[model samples]
Target chain A: MTAEALTTILIAMLGGAIRVSTPFIFVALGETLTEKSGRINLGLEGNLVLGAMVAYAISFHTGSPWLGVLAAGFSGVFLGLMHGSICSLKKVNDIAVGIAMMSFGIGVAFFFGKPYIQPSAPRLESLPLGGWASNPALQQALEINPLFIVGILIAIVMWWALANTRVGLVVRMTGDSEPAARAMGINPIKVRILATAAGGFLAGIGGAFLSLSYPGSWNEGLSSGQGLMAVALVIFARWNPLRCILAALLFGAAGALGPALQSVGISQGYYFFNAAPYILTLFIMVAATGSNSARAAPGELSIAK
Target chain B: MAQAETSFATPPAYDTARIRASIEAVAIPLGALVASAIIFSVFLTLLGKSPLQFFELVWRGGFGSSFSLQNTLQRATPLILTGLAFAIPARIGLVMIGAEGALVIGGFAAAALAIPLVSAEAPVYLTMLLMVLIAMAAGGAWNAIAGWLKHSRGVNETISTLLLTYIAIAIMNFFVEGALRDPASQNKPSTMPIGKDYMVGNIPGTDVHWGLVFGLVLAVALQVLMSRTTFGFAARVTGGNPRAALAQGLPVGTLIVVCSAIAGACAGLAGYFEVAAIHGQANASLVAGYGFTGILVAFLARHNPLMIVPVAIMFGAIEASGGLIQRRMDMPDATALVLQGIIFVVLLASDSLYGRFAIFQPKISTERT
Candidate 1:
């Protein structure tokens, strides 16, 4: 590739990484919180899709993108609550319920989202970050959404609180050892339910980013499997909130590779490149979990079991 | 609490306990199904649609006549194979959800292979056999990646398999839309058709293809293998307690890999049938959600091979009526998906009911009472 071509690809990938990583950041952070509380919500993909649909519909009706984002979060909370509550029942499998909730979320979204497919909703505004850049392409690429900043702040706060805060200590205690949590007068079920709902709220905001900023629309195929991919992202991030930001950015860059290359006239194997994030995630899972012992996994999580 | 203590104090007879266990197995799932139906009815009523009319349309479109019955059977053919795909891995305690990927890739491979074979004027039967074998091998290898990773690398098979599915679809799209695209198949890109003469024919007296026979035979064969054979016994032992199996020197890794391969092969065969018997070519059409629906079927059947047959058909009927419901009720095609989602949630939730009933409790410790 020529030097100019390389520059274009790099700039495009950087911008794409920012644009795409916003949703991943929210989802990965949310999954990090849930996993830290000893539950895995594999159904987040469902939440992502439903959140996208709900956000779009609410934005259209209320004429406010921010309201749409909040609606999306609440929708996600509802599904997460369902998954968490069902799983809290004795003999119920968390993983299976996650799958079922995923299906439920997607189905309901599709059923209600049919009418919103054609309407345009107000989009989230972006900050002009590259105003000083001479190239129009660079400036366009640097236009960043405010939600991206919010996601970063959340991750930082989560990292700090997980280490220092009392509520964080309780969640960590519940995750690391159920008996220990009980001995400390903590109700593991309530902690898990609340943590999962909070996680869902974050993931819902991620969905809003997809519909209100980037793709800026609602559709059945809006989220291919980003929600599901975030589950793997949490594992790759070692369930650390701060690490989740880096991991999400990495995934975003990987996702952008195909479009970046295509923009630079490298169209060969475009679809193959489109699959880069999934391939990257599979490799990460294999590498991270390759050891016989669950080194990075939460002690009480079913994924470790 | 007093009632439970009293029940524990007086044990039921062995025969009665055995009958009750069987009854609970049937009754619980039945109860879940009824609950789901009632819940779905409420959804319909809220939408100003009639639940009774929806059922009537489903019956008419899926099984009211011979034609619809045959269509249901044809749809069920793929579900049977895919159901077995999930069922097999589930038995080994791995959540392998890549059957859709296996099916698509396997079908694409079969379609790609047919081009060269047909050009060479290969015998029809020989060509068909090659297609089936190639598809099975492709699917088997695809799913084996998950099993191998799970056993050797400690990767979670659920996520690995799910990721592999998307990758598989991308791979298929790369080929079908680029290198393998047939020039004539514009707008909707597809591989070259397998040709009329080489296509698998319908059964003599019915419109259903031989894939149905393949599904039925394989289901029975798998049932026998899982219940009667020494390999099956070893697999059960390994699945029941991996540490004990390892202590007994059973090859746990091999069992996991083999079971996954078998599951993949089953899904691949479904793909082959789709190409050779149904679609006659590989295209975006091959990515139908049969693989995911099969997960529901397998779960509904509790992963029992024998039960998969009936369960597959039941789901097949529901799927076959999707269009009719859409037309009659003026609802989107996704209405069926909503019902399916409800059923899946209810069924999974009902799992908590297991062992909660005293009637189903084993009589082993009851001698003290």
Candidate 2:
């Protein structure tokens, strides 16, 4: 590849990483919180999709993108609450409930989202960070959405809270040892339910980013398993909120590789390139879960067991 | 020896207990189905649509007539295989959710294989047999990757399988859109058709293809194998308690791999049938949500091979009537999907109800007094 081509691909990938990773960042951070509480919400993909639809529809009707984002978050919290409550029942498996919740979310989204597919919605604004750069391409590439910045802030705050805050400590205690948590007068179920709902709220905001900023539309196929991928991203990040930001960006860059290469006139094996994130996730799961590195896992997590 | 044999013989109460347990097993799922139906009726009523009419349309469009029954059976063929794909690995305690990937890759592989055989003027039967074997092998290898990863590397099988599914779709898309694209397939971008002469024929006296027969036979054969054989016994033992199986010197890893491979093969065979009987070529059409639907069917059937038949047909009927419901009720095509989602959630939630009811419980010998 020529130097110009290489520069284009790199710049495009950088921009794509920012654009694509915003959703991943939020979803991963959300998943991180849930996993830290000893639960996994595989249904976040469903939440993401439903959130996208709800955000788009609410934005269209209310004429405010911010309200749409909040609506999406609330929708996600609703689904998450249902999932958490169902899973809290005796003999109920969290993983199975997640799958069922996913179907429920998707089904509801598709049913309600049919009418919103054609309507236009107000989009989230972006901040041009490369205004001083002479190159138009660089400036365009640097036009990052505000949600991406919000996601980063949330990750930082979450990281600090998870370490220093009492509530975070309690969640960590519940996750690390249920008996210890119980001895300390903590109700594991309530903690898990709240954490899952909060996680869902974050994931819903991620969905809003997808529909209101990047893709800027509502459709049935808006999310192609990004919600599901975030689960693996959390594991790759080792359950750390700050690490989740980096991991999401890495996955986003991987996702962007196909479009980036295509932009540079490298269309060969485009589909293969499109699959890079999934391949990366699978490899990461294998490497992270291997016997040597298993100690990084949360003690009470089912995936760890 | 005779005295010991007599003492070990089946007690009279054993039959009653077995019968009672079976009855309860059937009752729980049946109750779940009824509850879902009622819940769905409420949803329909809220929408200003008649629940009774909607159900009437479902029955009329799915199985009320000969034509509808045939359509239901045709759709059920793939469900049965995909249901088996899930049910088999589930027996080994693995949540292998990539059956869709296996199906797509298997169908693509079969279609690719057919091109060479058709060009060489190979006999139709021989070509199809080769296609089936290749598809099964491709799918088996696809899923075996997850099993191997789970056992050897401690990777979670569920995530791995789901990832492999996306990879499988990419692989299929790469080939279909590039190397294997038939020039005449234009907008759809499909592989070359298997040709009229090489297509699998319909079963005698019915419009349904031989795939239905294949599904039925496989379901029965798998049921027998799982319940009446040593391999099945070992698999159950491993599933129930892996540590115990390992302590007993059973090769648990091998069982996991073999079961996954079998599951993949079942899904692959469904793909072959789709190519040979339904679509007559491989394309994006092969990625229909049949593999995912099979998950619901398998779960509803509680992963019983024998029960998969009824569950598959039930789902198949629902799917077959989707278009009719759309036309008659003015609902979107996703109405059926919504119902399916409702059923899945309610059924899983009802799992908690098991053993809670006394009627379903067997009479304890001590409690009988």
Candidate 3:
């Protein structure tokens, strides 16, 4: 409540927001792209867990964090390919397949990740953005990872590409109408598969950010459903790449609220604060659903169905 | 292509078509099971473990003896209940995965309620009955939130149910680790135990608790409710086409909400039994993934209440063998999880096979081939 306490809470929350939101940024962007291609991959949660574990184990064994990140992305691609291929089959439900992929991805991750839980892995470094600040706490809070910048840049690029590029047109066409796309000589299935795989690649990188940067460890509990939350974020963002960054930052702040409050010597309702993002997402969803039909969604997207 | 044209050229008899439909229902899921088993065996072999030995151990550890069968049955109890939870909503075209959350909240509610009553020396029968009712009510209400949202606002039920699960767990954690934490439960924060005097006893001749009986009775009752009643008819119509159901003047929203509540209640009862029969207290242990596993059970059963019992028991047997598999094969307990994941994926993918099978294609013409 005091000026100093408020400063402390603000600084801690800012730091936590930067730390926690990086994963959200990548996953939301990934989901945004996938949804734009008329598919929703709920297995991104599994992708996150497996990516975190794979990133950590690869980093631990190779002593190269970047390599681990790359491996994590590839692991996500593999899972994404599995999801895309299975879902492409006739009569299969996309949502149910997503659920299966989630379980499969998580199960495989846990099975291989058991041994890497205790060992420390090489981690990604951050640039001190607050180097000119006099306060050490402020300086620490300003340290930003390279991925944060990369996420922002990618968002801008995606926003531009989605609106301008020939590839973007094909993707949009396919998402809007499968028959139309087929008439235009674009195979909707292929486009969706590739888009899903690309989305998965981003989600994997997001997982790497968790283990290699902030939490910076390989563990089963490393992700708290950040992957799943990305769907909500994409919806909140109206499937815009640029808006995903804002949504991710907001979620990061919400996630950081509990820890930030605890840092300021206020520990009451910590669990409630911990659950803020889910509640917020649910509220936003309810609010969003009330205003729109499938108007904001891709015509061929199966989420509502 | 020519063979298919020839088969289709002549209309088939009604009896043959009926036989084909029946066979396909059994054959598809059965084939999926066999396919997943083969894939799992390949996975084990790649890991340098003998697939043959692993399965033999599973059989011996799960159902080889009376004790093992009872253990499997005990574990199956929760799956059966949770499967119904998923199955009921699925019948109404809703993907409700909040059963896990419902179970946790339901169980936690039961434990939290027991504190003052036990201290007040409430009669054992009254206390137990109250706990069961409280658990079911808690769970039912919890899941109903998602159902209501889907109908009222068009919120995606799958995502909503998933979010509710996390919220449910957080709510339970808030209580168990805070106001209701028993000082005696160090290292693992937990609620005050209901005590052995209030614990539900097992069947007279078996080690399995009364939850099994509850699951059996509920499964049969729900099967009838879903297949043989007007409510069931309305639900099936809604599931097939919500727009059609609405056009028919069916209460679509009510059916959706009712199915979700029943699903939640079933899951909640599983939670109550976990408290009253197994753990004796509510803690992090109550957060076990029984609710998630029940999804696989329901899927394997094709969301049929009657079929859920058998599928759940098989899954339970697989899980009951986890410890044995871990020890004998030097594999992690997640081996079972991996197998389940594979089965689930394969089963869902096998949906494409349903209409593809020539035998399963019903001939409405009813003419002799």
Candidate 4:
């Protein structure tokens, strides 16, 4: 490929990375919180899809993208609550319940989402942060969504709280050792459940972005396992909220390889590029697994350590 | 307060009264099923639909007649394989959710491999063996990734497996839509048909293909592998306590990967049959939710391979009935999913029953009184 084309590909890739990373950022933050509290919600894929549908439907009805995002987050909370409550029941496996909830969530979303497929919904606005650039290509690549900033801020706050706050200590204690947590009179179950619900809420918001922002539309195909991939991303980030943000951006760049290449008239190996995120996840997991840092994962969390 | 005392008094006698405990397990799940139906009815009521009419429609559509039973069996055939896919690995304590991925990749690989054999005058049995092997290999490798990750990295198998599913599906879509698209079908991209003569034949009396038999055979084989073999014992030991298994010198990682590969192979075989027997080509037809439904089936069967057969057929009935409900009640076809989800959650919660049944606990305190 020509140097100009290579440059174009690089710019498009950066742009695509920003767009795709928004949802990952939201979901990774949520999963980090949930994992920190010693519970895992694998059903966020369901939450993402349902949130996408709700965001689209609500935006269509209210003509407000913000409202749609809020409604989507609430819908995610509902799913999270269901998963948390069911898992909290004695003898119920959290992972299994999460899997079941995923199917239930997606099924419900598809069923209810059928009507909104054709209708136009209000979409989120992007800020043209690259207006200062003289090059048109640079300007085109600068359309950043506001939610990206919000996700970053949430990650920073979560990181501070997890390291410093009393609630964070309790959550960490619960994840580190249930016996210690119980001895300290903390209800591990409740903490885990709340964390899961909060995580779901964020995932739901992430889903809403898909429908109400870039590639903006309501459809059954809007999500392709971003929620599920977030779980892997959590382990890659070592369950730290701040690290999750960086991981999300890296995943986004990997995911954008296909479309970004396509923009530069390179269509060969698009499938391989599309498979990049998963491949990256597998390799990162391999690198991190059984290692000192990964071993540092809280003992109670199932993904690592 | 009395951990040692409580632990020392657990032995109990078995009697006819224990049947009540079994009944309660079934009863609670049944109640949950009914409750989901009621809840679904309420949703329908809000949608301005009659709940009574929907049930009648489902009854008539799913099992009220022989034709429906046949349809149910046909649908259940795939579920049986996919359910076994989930159930088999579950026996060894791995939650392998990549069956869906295995199914798609298996179907694609099966169809792709069939391309070369079609023009040659090969023996029919040889051709079938080649197809099954190709399909199983595709699926086995797809699932082995998750297993390898879990055993190697301590990465949770569930999410990695699930992510692999999306990658698998995307690969299938790209291949079918781009490289393998049949020239004649413009709108919907698909592979070339495998032709009628090469297609799998149905059972003599039923419309269901020989895949149903394969599913049953697999279930039985897995039952044996899980119950009567040294491998089964090792796997169980690993599953029950990985640390203990390691202490005992069991090859825990190999067991996990091998079990996952077997599970994926089952799902891949299901995909192969779906292509060769039903769709006759790989397309959007292969993307249906059979793999996800199998997870429910596996869970409902309590992860028992032997139990998967009947439970699969039951779910098959529900799926067959979904169309009837949709046609008669104007409801969406996802009603079966709602019911399945409810049953799954309730059944899982019922796992607490092992110690709770009064019959299972000794009555020494009562005897003293």
RMSD for all candidates, in order, please.
3.4, 2.8, 3.0, 3.9
Task: Please give each candidate's TM-score.
Answer: 0.95, 0.96, 0.96, 0.92
DockQ of each: 0.74, 0.77, 0.76, 0.53
lDDT tens digits, residue span B1-369, model 2: 445534745674576568777887789889989999999999999999999999999899899899999999999999999999999988878877888999998999999999989989899889989998999999999999999998888888888888888899899888888898899999998999999888889998999999998899999999988889988888989888889999999999999999989999899999999999989999999889788889889989999998999999988898888889999899998888889888988888888887787766655522442
Docking class of 2: medium
lDDT per residue (tens digit) for residues A1-305 in model 3: 89999999899888988889999999999998988888989889888888988999999999999999999999999999999999899999888888898899899998998899888888999998999999899999999999899999999999999999999988888888899999999999999999999999999999999899988888878888899888888888888899899999989999889888998888877888888889988998888874563577888888745
Better of 3 and 4 by lDDT: 3
Candidate 2 structure quality by residue, lDDT tens digits, A21-117: 9999989998999989999888898889889999999999999999999999999999989888888877776777788888888898999999999
Residue A91, model 1: lDDT of 84
Better of 2 and 3 by lDDT: 3
Candidate 1 per-residue lDDT over residues B1-369, each given as its tens digit: 445545654444555577777777778888899999999999999999999999898888889899888888999999999999999888877788889999988998899999999989999999999999999999999999999998998788888988888898899888888898899998988998999988888989999999999999999999999889988888888878888999999999999999999999999999999999988999988889888889988888888898899988888888888888888789998888898899999999999999887657764334333
Candidate 1: misplaced stretches above 4 Å? A290-293, B1-19, B364-369
Mark the regions of model 2 whose C-alpha exceeds 4 Å error after superposition: A291-293, B1-10, B363-369
**CAPRI grade of model 1:** medium
